[model samples]
Target: MIDSHAHIYLEHFEEDVEEVVERAIANGVEKILLPNIDSTSIEQMLRLEEQYPDVCYPMMGLHPCSVKEDFEKELQIVEDWFNKRSFLAVGEMGTDLYWDKTFWEQQKEAFHFQCELALKHDLPIVIHCRETIDETILLVEQYEGKGLKGVFHCFTGTVDQARQITNLGFFLGLGGVSTFKNGGMDKVIPHLERSKIMLETDSPYLTPAPHRGKRNEPSYISLVADKVAEFLNLSRKELDDLTTANTNKLFFPSK
Candidate 1:
């Protein structure tokens, strides 16, 4: 199985991060893809990636919530990192109106800039759309002919929204929210195509049910897979193969 988006590298897991990886591997999570939050998170993310070169992978970008008045400077740092090394994608980037909307314009501008980077690097993007799904979709729509592709990470949107994203060649990432009785992903997952979906824990955050109130870790990916499989009516192994293939295609495109 693949954790398409996770931030276990953060301070939340600093105490027993090694054990966290061990538990995840023991539970069949073969890879954990780490997304950068901002300039401060890069080192921690890269450090974890180095420790588990094969198990943990790193992606570079400025998170939407982190966008501020001087977003241009933050973007410059993101672009500089891209020049310094390779990243699976140019994300954890997108618009978020759920929090402060003070830098709404800057968030959109930064998203566009990262989209341009994805087009230039021929890489995918891992998006974080909280309350701005349509707005984010519209921004991505502008790159329609530019070969932009990636996943709408932690997707808990409507079926229509899912169709819109998939139609554009992007993927939907399902997480713990789906397991919530009222999460409503039940309406979206079953109607979707298998190839255009992936599973994620969004760990240290959206911990799956039965463990909902506790700290989330990669080891619980199976709980998410179980819920997703129940929606698709597939076995655990079947779902794993499907999402893992999708993850590999995006992060390890050369394969």
Candidate 2:
């Protein structure tokens, strides 16, 4: 299994990062993808990647919420990292109206810039759309046939929206939210084909039910897998195999 998105590099895991990775591996989470939030997060994120190497892959991008007045400077820093080394993708990037709209225009521009970066680098993007799904989808549609491919990380949209996204050659990333009683994913997941789906934790956030409200960790991705399998009427192993295959093909295609 792969925890397609996690911020284990944050201070939340400062005291026990080792144990968290151990628990994830023990629970069969073969990889954990770390998405860069901004300039400040890059060092710690890269440190964790250097420590875990193949087990933890790092992606480069400026998160929407982090898009500020001087976002161009931040983007320059992000581009510098790309020149420095290869990343699994160019994301954790997208628009987020849920938090603050002060940087809305900047966020949209940054999202478009990063999308172009992904295409330029020939890497899949890991998108974070919060309360701006339709707007994000609209922007993405403009680049449909331009070879844009990425995942809608932490997707919580309707079946129709799912179809729109997958039809654009994108994938929906399911995580702890799928296990929530009123999260609406129960109605969404079953109607969609598993091939267009992938598993993630978005850890240190969106912890699954039975463990909701607690600080999420990668080890708990199994609970997410179990819940998704239950909704899709498939065994846990089958769900794991299917989602794992989807993730591997997206992030590690040659493998």
Candidate 3:
């Protein structure tokens, strides 16, 4: 299976990222896509990619939470990287109003900027919409026919919102949240379009049930897959095949 979204490059795993990758591979997670937060993360993210070129795919973007005063400079750095190298996608960028709304306007600006970057680079986007899925959807709708595609990473929206996103030709990335007893995804997942869904772990965060309070890792994606399989009423293998194909089609189309 492919862990379509993860941040194993973060310091949480610095002591044993190698072992984390091993555990993920052993647990059948073949690929772990890493999304950049800002300029500060580029080096460690790329280093992980270089060390595990085949397994750790990196993406470029300035996260919404990082959309502070110097956002333009951060975006310029991200753009320069795109000009310098290849990335699987342009994201984990989107509106996140969970913590504070002081940078809401800046976050919107950055989100649209990166959405254009996705289309400009002909790449899928990985979104992180926290407490603002609808607003994010409205922003994304403007690019519906411009060949902009992506996944709503760590999706926890309602069924109606899921319909809105998938109808816009985007995919919903499910992770540890689905395994949460209070996550409320069980009602939403069953109603989602099968092909418009994919699996992710968002590692080092959103750790799943049976390990909710602990740090998440790519290896735990199988548990995510298992719970999601239950949600969609498919066997583990079926969910694996479906999500793997979906993830490849989106981020690794050449494969």
Candidate 4:
């Protein structure tokens, strides 16, 4: 199975990063995709990618929360990295109003710029929408015919909103939140098309239930999958195979 988004590269796992990767592989996670938070995170992200090669892929983008007054400069840094190497996607990029709203406009601008970058590179984007799903959808709508395709990573939207995203050729990335008792995803997952679904851990955050209070790791993806499979009335293998196919269709189309 593929962990479509994770940040194991961060200092969150500094002491035992190798053990975390081993545990993930042991738990049957075949790939772990890493998303860059900003210029500051690029070094560690690339370092981890280099160490793991194809097993741990890297994506380039400025995270929404990281968007600030000098976003243009940060964007330039992101674009420069794109020119330097190929990435699995151009994200985790999107607007986040959950945090400070000081950089709201800059967040939108950064999202648009990164979306254009994804289009230019013919790559998918892994979005990060927090309390700004509607706005993010509207912005993505502006690129309807421009070959935009990707996943709304860590999606926690309404069923209709899920439909809106998938209708535009994007996937909904389900994570640990889906397993929460009151996470509300249980009500929506069963209603959405399984083909448009992808499983992710968003690890080092959103750890699945039974392990909710602990620091999240890719190994817990199996728990998330198990919950999704249960709700969808599917076997774990069936769910994994389906979501892995969806992931490949989005991130590894050439293969």
Candidate 5:
């Protein structure tokens, strides 16, 4: 299985980072993609990738919430980082009105800029949409045929939304939220064709049931897979195979 998105480089795993990764591997997680938050996190994320070259792949971009008055400078730094090395994608970028709408216009500008970067580099993206799906979809539609490939990380949208996104050639990223008892994802999952879905943990954040409220780790990705399996009425192995295939197609297409 692949944890299509996570932030294991965050300080939350400072003490047990290795163990957390080992536990994930032991539980069948084969790869993890770490999306960058901003200029501040680039070093930590790159260091993690260096330490676990095969297991951790890094993405470059300024996160929605991180957009501020100096967002252009931050984006320049991100672009510099990309020019210095190869990155799997140009994201963890999108619109987020949930926290502070004061920077909505700036966030939109930043998201579009990063989307352009993805097109220029010909890499897939890892979008972070929070309470801005309508605008997110609108911006995504603008890039339609530019080879704008990506996954809507931590997807919590409706069935119609899911269909619209998939129709645009993007995949839905299912994470720990899917395991929440009352999460609307259960209904949303059935509406999606498994081929259009990918598994993720968004770790050190959305920990699954029986472990909610605790610091999430990649190891808990198994719990997510189990829930998806139950929802799809398939065995865990079957679900893993399908989702893993979807992830590989998106991130490691040649494989």
Candidate 6:
């Protein structure tokens, strides 16, 4: 199975990062994608990728919430990295209005700049939309016909919104939030075609039901697959096959 989105670079796993990754592999997770938060996290994420080259693939981008007054400088650093190395994608980038709106303009600028990078590099992206679905959709539409593609990670939108995103050739990334009793993803997941979906853990956050409120890790991605299987009325193996195939198409395009 593939964890299409995760933050194993965070300090939460600094003490047992190796064990955490081992647990994920033991749990059946094959590949894990690490999306960068900002320039600050680049080295740590790159180190994790190097340490576990087979399992951890690094993505470069400035997270919406991380956009600040120095966002331009941060983006310059990201651009420089992209020029020097090949990354999985330009991602974990989008608009986040859930937090302070002070940096809304900066977020938009950063997102557009990253989108341009994706176009130039001919790579996909991992969008991080939070309470700004409308704005994000608008930006995505602007990239239409420019070969822009990627997943909307931690998706929490209406069926109509999901359709809109998929229509634009993007995938919906489902994680542990779907397992929440009150998450409402139960309703949303059923409406989405399995082909347009990809599984993710977003760890160190959104841990599944039995482990909710605790620190999330890639090992719990199975819980998400199980929930998705139940939601779609399919077997676990079926869900895994379908989502894994979709993930491979999006993240490992060459393969």
What are the lDDT scores of the predictions, listed in order? 0.92, 0.92, 0.92, 0.92, 0.90, 0.93
- The predictions' CA RMSDs to the true structure, in order, are 0.7, 0.7, 0.7, 0.7, 0.8, 0.7
Tens-digit lDDT string for candidate 4 (1-255)? 999999999998999999999999999998999998998999998899888996899999999989988789999999998898889999889989998899898888898899889989999988999999999999999999889999999988999999999999899999999999999988999998888999999989999999989999999999999999998999999999999999999998888
lDDT of 1 at 154: 93
**Candidate 4 segments exceeding 4 Å error:** none
Task: Give the clashing pairs for model 5.
Answer: none
lDDT of 1 by residue, 1-255 (tens): 999989998889989999999999999999999988999899999999899999999999999999987789999999999998898898889989998989998898899899989888999998999999998899889989778999999998888998999999999999999899989988888998789999999989999998989999999999999999999999989999999998898789777
Q: Tens-digit lDDT track for model 6 on 4-25?
A: 9999999999999999999999
Give me the runs in candidate 5 sitting further than 4 Å from their true place.
Answer: none
Candidate 1 minimal-lDDT segment of 10 residues: 246-255
| Superposed model 2: Cα runs more than 4 Å off | none
TM-score of each: 0.98, 0.99, 0.99, 0.99, 0.98, 0.99
In model 1, the clashing pairs are none
Worst 10 residues of 3 by lDDT: 91-100
lDDT of 1 at 5: 87
Flag clash pairs in model 6: none
Poorly placed runs, candidate 3 (over 4 Å): none
Q: Which stretches of candidate 6 lie over 4 Å from their true place?
A: none
Candidate 2 residue lDDT tens string, 187-252: 889998678899888989999999999999999999999989999999999999999999988889
